[model samples]
Target chain A: MAKVLMKGNEAIGAAAIKAGCKYFFGYPITPQNELPEYMARELPNIGGVFLQAESEVAAINMVYGAAGAGARVMTSSSSPGIALKQEGISYIAGAELPCVIVNIVRGGPGLGGIQPAQSDYYQATRGGGNGDYRHLVYAPATIQETVDLLMEAFDVAEQYRNPVMVIGDGMIGQMMEPVEFKEPKKRPIAPKTWSTDGTKGERKPNIINSLYIDPQELEDHVIRLENKYAEMKENETRYENYNVKDADVVVVAYGTTSRVVKNAIAKCEEEGIKIGLIRPITLWPFPDKAFEEITDRTKGILTVEMSTGQMIDDVKIAINGRKPVHFYGRTGGMVPIPDAIVEEIKKISGGVK
Target chain B: MLKDNRIRVITGHYGSGKTEFAVNYAVKLAGVNKKVAIVDLDVVNPYFRSREKEGFLSDLGIRVIGSSIKGASSDLPAISGEVLTPLQDETFEAVLDVGGDPIGARSLGRYHEYFQKGKYDMLFVINANRFETQTKEKTIAYLKNIEVQSRAKVTGLINNTHLLRSTTIEDVLRGQELCKEVSEELNVPIRYVSCIENVAKELPKDIEGEIFPIKMYMREDWMS
Candidate 1:
């Protein structure tokens, strides 16, 4: 297929359709409105379902219903909107129904602002809903990568019978870039035999519920979820290593921040500084293995983000105090520029040297 | 510089480089010592609207009119009454940076009377690399939709096709081919072939429209 320029939000909608997703339920929100709008305009043409629910809360429940019935479903919202859907997300995860949820993150403890920010890192990786449930989370740095991951998000969700998140800051939702919908690598996916589709008296009806009232049954269910999460940690962990070997300073970042960090690393290189980067593609699995690339020459680890160091906690755990971790960030919808990141890298490198 | 009419309305698909073309055309009009006012009638897209560059364009003596809401992050679909100033007054050579779809173009529907009363050139911008406008048929569908929604006929066509930093001469030519087809089909003339200077220099002179070199006003160096 020929490459065409597309905004990140529209590309996501197109990718979801290409991935065989036919049901979309979402509400309007800044930076991510294009995704729902695209789905609304195009879905009907393809005999797919697109509904603008009353609110984010209502939308996720709609997603829940569709996913339970063995349909590839999706819903998207920004930070605050994602917060509203947390309860439903928890239910989806607990029910072990496959679905995709996209968060084109904006700054927020509340309705913060419409510009890009990664403050929701904790909310995404730590599971915003109440439960011992964990789901797959993918953070793509580029629009092409965003579409590619979106195409695969459904397969991964169905394979594990778990919810999958494809998150990017508002930049990834709004920015335009050339993209081609490439087919993802084939994965071994089990049939949706566990779905609540009617049995027509041929077999016992499948029940979809997150509740296990008995304490032992609940414990067993929790352990089963844990094992699924363990499998995901083993198989789905993805990270990118750039110029990591023999570097004076290593930087860890993801999504839009990682792109800025790459530019900063290039600028540092011109000043006789060797800087390496570990870009986490999956925020959940956290890419702890990428830290092994930090060599003896590495002075310290620097984490850059659009938020004020939310991902720093994961970085600390990943490094496990093996190297000093430094942080540089901009919040309230402010994006970290390359020069600012370079200065922080210099500051960390200077202290260790 | 579109001197064919006092009011130049720029419309196209979102990401079709309509805002970029409007900014460049406004700057060129200002360069010629003409009094210019650039009205940002784009309420559909929250990001990268011409209103975001108000300060930069203001310093160049181009008056910028945008949403009544002030803050940068506010996504309210509000347009200020000041937008009508350029349309009412004949002294200013105005550039209207309209939103990119049929729904977005509806913002201009309210001012249909003013457009019809005054001499206006509604230039429909085209980017062949854009998904919806990739083919002649698709491009015509969008063009016809914009016209119906805006309640205004497209007076001119602009081949402002690009892939941002990755744009090449061939990409611009591809846009030209689509624009030429649309022009022939609709009887609207191709008015400008817009692109960055490096790519603009490589375009063949036989192309239908005049080459208009543009700077990266809306896009930043770090965007790619």
Candidate 2:
């Protein structure tokens, strides 16, 4: 189709529709309200369902219900609303239902603030909800990535019969950017192997649920989830590395903060400071092994975010504390400007006068 | 006592039930035959908000003002409301449901001059379980920062610390202690301690605030 200038949130909504998602349920929240509003307007035109649920809780459950019925289902929300949806997410994960969840994150410890924030990195990567489940997490830094990853999210979710999260921040959701919508990829027809559609002739009733009180059965289910996650890590790990050759300082970031770090790296390069970046495309199954390859060449790693050191813990763990890792960020709707990041890079590189 | 006609600024941590309190209190005050207006100044948090349910509040004869839902993409016109102009008129009581946290509360800075022209009481709600301010000292510091950012003194405290569907009397007691600490430290009165059930018998004698009971029913129509 024709390319259009779209906000990241709208791009995600459109991409979901193109990916055969016919059921969308969500509550309107800032930074990502456009997704639902767009879906509300467009879904009816295509004979799809769009529901402005009473709350995030109801919306996620509605998504669960739709996904259970073997429909391509999706939901989007900001951090606080996403927190409210965690219970449903856990249930979805337990049920092994295929669904897409988009978290256009904002600041939060509890209603932290509705500004662009990478505060939910740990929550997204480490399974925000509960139990021993992990979602296929795709972190998109640009508007184009938002569109592309959303389409990929559905494919990945179905392949594993698990929940997949398209994790972006307020910057991606709110900022206007020029984007070219590539022709929608042809998706496979819904697998008829295990869906709740009434049995026709030879098939039997299919049940999709997360409740398994049997210890051995639950253990078997957990093992199945683990194996799926292992397969995903082996086959689905993705990241972007920039200017790591002989670099003394490596900055690790993802989503919007990574864009700022990119600018900071350019500034440092101008000053003859060799600073590189490792931006994870998939936050869960985080590019830990990818980062480990460069630990020996880099002097230290700087973890940057829009929140106070939330994602730094992950970076530190990824490095296994082999190198000194420092963190700098602004909290509660305050974004870290490129200058601040550049300054931190200079400080870490010992180039500060 | 003179009729306190200042714009009441209600704020708290997330999931602290600030929106529920603000909505019920604003509607209750309006129900008592008072000219009441509520401006949803919360743009930060998303889930529990009075503005999202503007249609319901408007039915109760409460004038609801908020940021244009259309201009949500841009931070245009920081909380412009007709309610501020009528705050000086003792005939109307204005309540601004500021967003949670200091940054969310900072949007109120634009209305500082207008608030100064009339009486306004800024109330800070406290939930002891929320991060960053689970203790009294931390909560006081957060409130002070909010006070500095908005140029509005927190004149009262509301104890609303409750877990989702798991709130207990013990939680309320802990919240009460935090409330007392804030009241003494900030020299602000405890305006009300909110609870879903009536636990008036358990309240300490020295606790002076009125017990505000909240009844929240999930609408069946919305469910369908």
Candidate 3:
């Protein structure tokens, strides 16, 4: 279709539909409310299902049920709501069901604010639910990127038989931008021969359960999950590097903050400072390899986030003491401006240790 | 810069971008040395209020009179002391960015005394793309409701019909037809046909109404 000027939430809904997702379960929340509203109005007309569950928790379990039945399903919510769905997400992950969960993150600890925030970095990357399980997390910088990532999120979920989380802050959820819906690629998915849809009295009933009373079987499942994660880390780690080949200070950010940092980098460049941006598109894999290419010209790393120093931990871990990593962040729904990030770049270059 | 009205009230249904238009109009007025003060009368929407751009507008020498607390997310209509400045001072061409819908326009009832003496034009900004007021009949209904709550007459219409990036010259033309219907029925003059300046520069010149080319300063995180 032609390029449409759509809010990030609306684009996510359109993209999900284009990706052949007919089942959507969601609850009303600020910033990301457009997604459910879009689904509610359009899904029914297209011979699909859009159900507003009683709560976020209920929504996710519905996603788990639909996914188990070999139907592509999704559920979306903001940060607090995402928190409520964590248990269901854990259950879905443990059960190895392929589904998509979108977290249009808002400021948080407990109902912190309704504004945009990337505070859920740790929550998203670490899997909000309990278990030694990891699902791929994709962080998008633009509305267009959010659409593209959500389309890929479903395939990635089914390909790995894991629930994938597509995450963005309120800014990415609320802002209007031009987005082109490309023709959905014909994804090659493994046949759901293991689904519990029905046996038709053919063979033994397939049981999709997470609980393992026996220790060995549980350990085997853990090993299998670990192996799958390892494969994803090797094959699915994604990142975008800008002007990093010969830079003195490299700035790391993701989602909406990355856009601001890009403007900061441009401002810094005019002042004869060589700065670069390392935006992590897939926050899960963390793009550890991107750090290896940070050239000898690089002196220090600055991680800018909308939260108080969450993603910095990952940057420091990836850098591994080779360089001092500085952190600049605005928390509790305060967004970082280009001028502030530019000032941070100046401070980093001036040896503000 | 407003020819007939020194005090202008911009109102519309939700998502019609009345605030965005108000901000741009005030900025344009301030650019030409006409003393401008924008009163953020919108207490309905917590996001995308003109008050949030106070720092930027203040830098341009335009007075931004908003809520007492800077950058407040509260929905309460806590009127600042500075909101009354436009009523007394005839030199300052003030623009009231009223909240969307009738409930938001209710606050204007308190300013009824000042609006009687002061030359004012309440422009109802219309976007044909919004679901509530997409049709000409629905637009007229919205206008009537706003007029009822505010207890003020709407003197003009600003056709700001767009679909964000997908807005075409055809969308503008289609919206003009809707505005013509409203204009003939309500007898309110159509002020300006607005689109983004980029699109305005590309129109095929087959439409009606004076083009108010808009350049947005308040934008998404990625737009920067």
Candidate 4:
């Protein structure tokens, strides 16, 4: 394995290439411009297609077209741009296409700041598009983790016949760290008998569309997608627990915020505060099982996020009122410093409500 | 050795990698206990500015003077007072990581008199492998424009032609040839040919100019 210090955005781009993804379509957006720039400069040399489409709307549709044709295709954007592609994303999911989409997220309800924020958690995990479908969402905290997840993201997408989103805050996107692209796994996936390129006069033309105007037919499709999501919940959920074996406060977080929470947890441990961390590697399929590992000593659960408090829902739903859950966040481009999180931990421990 | 050239000043266009080069250069000097300090004058774009790297460099005992409001909500161009203080420390050599384009060099222009007053080598890092600086004449124009904007003459040329991890020995050699041509045409000495460590190890033994093997400071995290 070869390791190099690379930014998160760059590692994702390289991992996409390593996964044999030969087609890319994306519009330029901050914190993620590096990915497209890398693809633009590198793709041509390898005889791959890197298209800077007219707009984010067009880009996602192009990815949809490419993925539908059986090419491993991808696209990426920051908050605002990803917003524009919601319609296309919904269609892709409805059509059950296997593709990779990365949201190197920035702050937003609208065209927010360029800085990193995990404001897109609800949209990403809940599905941005209007649909009765869900995509496998991976929220990687480190550059290496991002690479490993991304290298397998394509295979996961294909395996489930659904889209795979690598959601990360701007920090995870822009920060520099060593990332190693390991040898490609012989990921077993169902062969594409559904690709439109085939049936060359041997069979009828293949069609890929998400529209099901009929209520009952659409309901059947929705049930089918729901079953797939349930299977994913049973099999694909992943998480990491640090020092939770004996702790009173088990803080839950994902992506960039988990790093800060871990640091905060260390400070509390030194003071004999007995705090721990549970990081969700996968956002969707939520990693709800992590909550079961909490102990009798676990007095409280705190969910930390870059946004005001999006992932807290998943944490609460998972904990199911078994323990009181707290939330600490930094929104609109502010990163919660370690000290701030430590304060939150103390407040929880001292029974400050 | 390249270390002899103290008070190094780097100025180039956006994406020319002046910040990355300056960071590695400062780290190298600090590693040798040379009392190194890096001054960040990039008030133009705050995102990739050298000041953002203060925490990383300061951990290594290298004093970094960057924007006071670095990574803050407000990205106003707030240059720190400590920026020029390092230049006064005789024991401390400094690296002035100037910003991109004429607009960016305005901050350097504020300290132009001070830089010219000291024993410094203003390096015009050639933006090789990029279209604007692909040719000698075009590269010369950029150098001249930056010099005029910053009001400082470039004492030397640094061939930093690259395409991240994709840079091969041939790319470095090709860049060296361009630097050679520009070196002769502009009458500026070719001080170093900067390449990442991996490719530098494979550089031809008989290459021209001093080869300065450097770490990738640019957003090369994506390069495999």
- The candidate scoring highest on DockQ is 1
Q: Please say which candidate is ahead in TM-score: 1 or 4.
A: 1
TM-score for each candidate, following the candidate numbering: 0.97, 0.62, 0.83, 0.73
Off by over 4 Å in 1: A351-353, B116-118
lDDT of 4 by residue, A1-353 (tens): 53344656767888899888899999997778779977997888889999999999999999999999999999999888988989998898899999999999988879778787999999988877886778888999887888889988999999988889998888887775655778557667998888899787898888999888999999999899999989888978999988776677888888878887877777777787888788999999898888888887877888899998999999889989888999989999888888888898888788333
Instruction: Tell me how candidate 2 scores on lDDT.
Output: 0.77
How far out, in Å, is residue A85 in model 4? 1.1
Best of the candidates, TM-score: 1
Candidate 3 TM-score to native: 0.83
Residue A29 lDDT, candidate 3, scale 0-100: 82
- Candidate 2 Cα errors over 4 Å, as ranges: A183-190, A295-297, B1-224
Residue B56 local lDDT, model 3: 93
lDDT of 2 at A287: 84
- Tens digit per residue, CA lDDT, model 3, A1-353: 54545668878998999898999998888768778988998899889999999988889989989999989999999999999999998998899999999998888899778788999998998877898999899999988888988998888899889999999998888776667877645566788888898899997888888999999999999999999989989988999998887788999999989999998888877788889889999999898888987877787899999998888988988989988999999988888999988887888788333
* Prediction-by-prediction clash tally: 0, 1, 0, 3
In model 3, what is the error at residue A277, expressed in angstroms?
1.4
Candidate 4: the clashing residue pairs are A6-B221, A7-B221, A10-B222
Per-residue lDDT, model 2, residue A247, is 79
